[model samples]
Target chain A: MKVTHAKLLAQVPLLTDLPTELLESLAKSCRFEQVNRGHVIIERHDTTRRFFFLLSGQVRMLDLNRQGQEIALAILDAPTHFGELAVIDSLPRSASVQATTRCEVASISPQDAEKLIYTVPQVSRKIMQNMATVIRNNNLHRQVLQQQSISNRLAAYLLGQLPKDIDPKETVCIRNLPIQYDLSILLGTTRESISRALTTLVDEGLVTKDGKNLYLNDIPGLYQLLEED
Target chain B: MKVTHAKLLAQVPLLTDLPTELLESLAKSCRFEQVNRGHVIIERHDTTRRFFFLLSGQVRMLDLNRQGQEIALAILDAPTHFGELAVIDSLPRSASVQATTRCEVASISPQDAEKLIYTVPQVSRKIMQNMATVIRNNNLHRQVLQQQSISNRLAAYLLGQLPKDIDPKETVCIRNLPIQYDLSILLGTTRESISRALTTLVDEGLVTKDGKNLYLNDIPGLYQLLEED
Candidate 1:
């Protein structure tokens, strides 16, 4: 395999599992592109016939309502993929994707991606598994974000990041949260409101913040706050 | 084919398109069950091993945040399917499914469903297509609900339900929205708040309440309102 093709395929967990021959075939069809920060990879309601897998950098899926208030649906890091809807059904883009940072992405024509899935059994299973994962995570996230209360939203968001096997009483540190401004956008609140909510959380003994990292010393207490909402 | 089996298979839009022999084979492994109103067909965090297809009746997909605030994800009518995550990958149920009305349902083991998807090309394509449809609708619904304001939320909700082919200037009546209580739960607001939003829409000449229906007289005006918020 070519070094660049191998690197891109290795980055995406889904493509790494494909057999060498199939990977070689897919790599041959792959087109490499570099997108600048704030570049819109796809636009809402555009009927385009392409699928993109982010090889490096960050991509934000943006939703802008009629009032022009924009919220992010998701922020995807490299090795993650987008645009599978058009790949599957030629559907118009429902949301826009913009590079949150200068990014490298590998492009595949919908026809090429469809051919990989339809004609290759192993590739089909791997692709389906990846799609299932996207659907599962999306449902779980929508459920959490549906909470009405800001504190509840924050608590739920925190608890969601905790390791599943961790005990409730253990101290947990959550890192990698979006900054306050972006978080407010995701939670549909103002920066001031989000700050106030965090302060309230701190006063209530649910969490402590050390810069960008948050410490949860009373995990069960936080659960109680979420439960009592 | 058994008459009951054929009847059940024919009712499901996803399965009706499959060959009769294949459907018959699938029906052989099916287990029929009757769920009462408010029956919990699936539970969040439950590691259940089956996927369900609603043969007759109404079902609500629900999400309860850690705060115990419950919201309905969707209200699915018969001839619809759910729980493919477990079938495809044996993942735990991410959300709950409850019977909104007394209902009849047929279930297939994940093993059996996997057999069909892996061995039958047409069945695999059909299932994937159905999944793509679900993912697409989920993304769109999430986008509409991500807006920050209640009035904006209500307006976006109404606009989303409009038929795609309708002209922007045309008159449209949206009916069968959840009752105020349910709408409040779904929209993350109080019944009083939802009422206020609707009244505001009426006062703005964007929507006119006619009995149980909402007549959207100027679709663009409603959209403009959505943009301004």
Candidate 2:
């Protein structure tokens, strides 16, 4: 089965707002490539201004913290875009991206991206909306990182993972806990620390795990952890 | 002497790209207000979508960390804008804003702002650029906050304060260190802790302070602090 470039571009959230002709034009100019796991997709401080859209598989966004330790900013899955900031604003890449799995990605030159943004109302508005989301997510990440204790940060992250409108009295089950390795990266702690924190929550009867599903037994108690020092 | 609304709008970085006629139309829809020190300008989770431009004085961006403590995210002086994220994306305010000094500001309805962004290429690009900077700064802030100790975070913050192009061998002086109260808030620590951290840096000969000016006596040594536990 062959997927047309235009079909792939149309699947992107940012380009979905674009009319068919624009998407076709974008499809024509974009360069598509596939790489195996651990291949660097983008390097930190690289000045190349290209917008990348992930069509398949996953990539890890990595940056060095002040301690020169490589920290995972995020694990981005397919049907998403990265490097738009550098393309739109001409800033150097702030973080590096490496394939976590064999991945297919498409990249468009900065000039073409800029032209589409300037001439197309839908594309411009969508760009702003997407950037707004990135800003909001980053702000939330900073708030979560500000938690001084691992368990407190873990509780906050769990609370975030739950549905926003979940009933406080309802016993909710979260089936999508990231694997221990990814959890450690997201939580900025070691695998041992993540285990310890989860145990602390389970021992306190706030959460319970059965096989792959983790149940939030006491939502209020989990919230209370965030208030503690 | 008085400032015309259009004249004020012309001074905003986002609006600088707008032509005079567009600026004038925008000015017609904006409302001006004056707030005294400590007045809450925008409450977090508030649904109101208005773009505010500070004409005078200053405001602090504040949010509650996971521990339920208010942390200062940043401070903005006059001739700046906030709330664009909410205006564009219709998200609830992510953080609150309070006047740090007596302030004058103007706000535009979301419709006018969106209209300008959709119709004006320069304005749209400027908005994206501004959002890009916000995302980058947030990334850096999260990296700094990930440091385990106050002194390490302080050192990272100090390094950030220096000019990016400063010569490594040249001694640099920073006269614009935020007031101790603000620095404490920025570093997520107590004023006493900030004092302790500074004394440690000074006593170690990495920094020297004389009155209001602080000199980076050993830039490389300061960088080394971040690599420590």
Candidate 3:
């Protein structure tokens, strides 16, 4: 998509609630770029000052171990945002983000974003509100992860993926699976362990796995597994 | 301190850069109060619209666990601030703060702070700057804790207590230390482990513990311990 067109569409709540004209101006100040799969978008400790919005495809935010093994911190799908922390704090990126698939992204320099926000009160309010949501969600995830057991963590995470008002008994199909390695990192376990756990669930008729897709066969059974003594 | 005096002192900063009469009016809006040790200053999930500034003594920010354990997240000493997160986000408190020692605090209702800041541009700038500093420090601590090992984390925690720009070789004394249980929670470990580590450090001549006081016998040695395999 052309940078102008992409920026116009980006104003769809995820970017800001600014008017089209304002968003177009903001977009003009930003740069649009495509990154290939396996491209490192951001590097830990790199002091580059850019905020990113995923326009298409996926990016995995990861922290590297001493030996450089990547541990997935989060996965940002299209329409989601990342790199706001650097812009907010004027600090180096805390974690690296790598393209999990060929992706399109919109980039805003920190100075540009700050200038726009200060000059536009509406933009500043919208950005602050967006940041507040991010902070709230991040804090909630940290709390849940710190307190929940591995199984409970996985269950809660899966449940969160469902619609907010969905019936508890509703069977939802999950497709375009997040990689097992990513799941392992999120659960603070090994991919082998995640595979073993999923296998157990499948054998028990709790969930059905077909290739890269999974369907909830028994929601109660999954809950039982989460609550197992 | 008397409420009137505390209110007056709180106005000093807000008034310094504002017109003299405006500062006096803002000061009149503040509410001063003393809270004894163990008093709950702010309750979790409370939407009470008040922000606090520490005048004296210590306060602890805590989150309660399901098992009823109070996880101490931070200690706020004199001249420090708390309750600003709720004010900024216009949300209920996510954590509770209590007086760890008899605390004298000056408070401004969120509405009052908002009014004063809106009327006084200088006050708004100062408050924003203060918030940025607090957020940056909080994020830095979170990153350090997430990335460092237990020993290194402990060492860094101790180092943070010392005066900045002090000679690295200079030893500092920590007196009337809090209980081991408190230290365990702060370091994300158990009391037994903290006791064991302290004993080991003592044996290694890195530190000395006598009664309620700990003397760092060798600052460089403590740093080496943090860098150990």
Candidate 4:
């Protein structure tokens, strides 16, 4: 789908909070690009000239291990903003972002982003708050993953990815699991470990898998698993 | 130790950049507190009404695993600032901070910190830049640690803790080792792993260990080891 001006401006999380006039200005400054799956949208060491926000589809932020294996940092979906670090620090890109699926993304020039920071306090504060949230949550998530148990890591990883606003009683259906190989990269483990953990979760009736969809029967069960020695 | 108006203001990294009038205002707003070793300066759910800067001695940021084992996050020395995340986001403290030694720490209320942000653009920019640097470096460090090598982790970790301005060619001394238990917690490994990794480094002449003092004989050797796997 082509990214329409008003629709996209109002849809993106970054611009959605702005007033109509500011949104209009943002819309004017943004350039929308459609990228195919497997497109490397941003490479490590890329210039700090522009920031990106996903309007649709998925993107993976990743790094390469010394052995040339891809280590997944984050798998981001629509309404997500990234690359702001480069803008804030005026530094080269620290990681690579690639399209995991055909994606619609909006790019904003750093000059415009900086102008927004000074001219628009509300937007600036929101961005900073968002960054703080990411930093804090990412730190917590990494701490969970650092433990030596693959089961605990997978459980904590799944729980961490749920939206903050997700209803406690809601049965969250996650169907976009790419594949076991991809999941292994995300957890920094092997495909065998991912499969083993999934089997255990299924055997315990904590979660059920049907085709590409996974169902959480008991969210607290996952937490209980983490508490196990 | 009493916190003199000039001495305290000069030592705190946050206030050092401000002009005299501003520093005077900040010094007045700050509360200088001397804490003893093992003092719990901040708890997990503490309010973010104030921020802290260490004037002297060591502070450790830590968390408890489900089994009640401690997980070390960071060990900070003088001229370090923390709890700004709470101040920035108005969120509860994400972790616990304990004084690792008798410490002199100065704190500023969020209200005063806000005043500085409005009154001092350069200082605010510098704080943001520092925060961005933290986020980037933390991400990289976590990535390095997540790989499955205890020796690589200890090497990368020591290299990481070195002051960024340290001369690459100079023989820098880091004598503030926090014992084997704390080192194991920081690396999410067994105490035995820490001992083994240290022995390996010493054996290879990559680093030399003298009592609690560990000396890096060749920093590049550690980096090369990381590149090997």
Task: State in Å the error of residue B215, model 3.
Answer: 5.8
- Arrange candidates by lDDT, descending: 2, 1, 4, 3
TM-score of each: 0.86, 0.92, 0.76, 0.86
The C-alpha stretches of model 3 lying farther than 4 A from their native spots are A1-3, A6-15, A65-69, A144-177, A200-229, B1-23, B66-68, B113-179, B187-193, B200-207, B210-229
- The digit string of per-residue lDDT tens for model 3 on B164-201 reads 57776766787756678767666555688778867777
**Candidate with maximal TM-score:** 2
Task: Please list the residue runs of candidate 1 whose C-alpha ends up more than 4 Å from where it truly belongs after superposition.
Answer: A1-4, A147-152, A190-212, B1-4, B143-152, B175-184, B189-221, B224-229
Candidate 2, residues A59-176, lDDT tens digits: the string is: 8888877656677788888888888878877878988999988999999888887787667788778888888887777777777777888888888878877877889887899885
- Best candidate, DockQ: 2
Question: Between which residue pairs do clashes occur in model 4?
Answer: none
Alpha carbon lDDT of each predicted model:
0.77, 0.82, 0.66, 0.77
- Runs of candidate 2 with Cα error greater than 4 angstroms are A1-3, A209-213, B1-3, B209-213
Higher-lDDT candidate of 2 and 3: 2
> Which lDDT tens digits does candidate 4 get at residues B76-154?
8887777777777888887789998899888888887666653466656666666788778767667666756899888
Error of 2 at B85 (Å): 0.8
lDDT by residue (tens digit), candidate 3, A119-143: 4555444555555554555444443
Better of 1 and 3 by lDDT: 1
For candidate 4, what is the DockQ-based docking class? acceptable
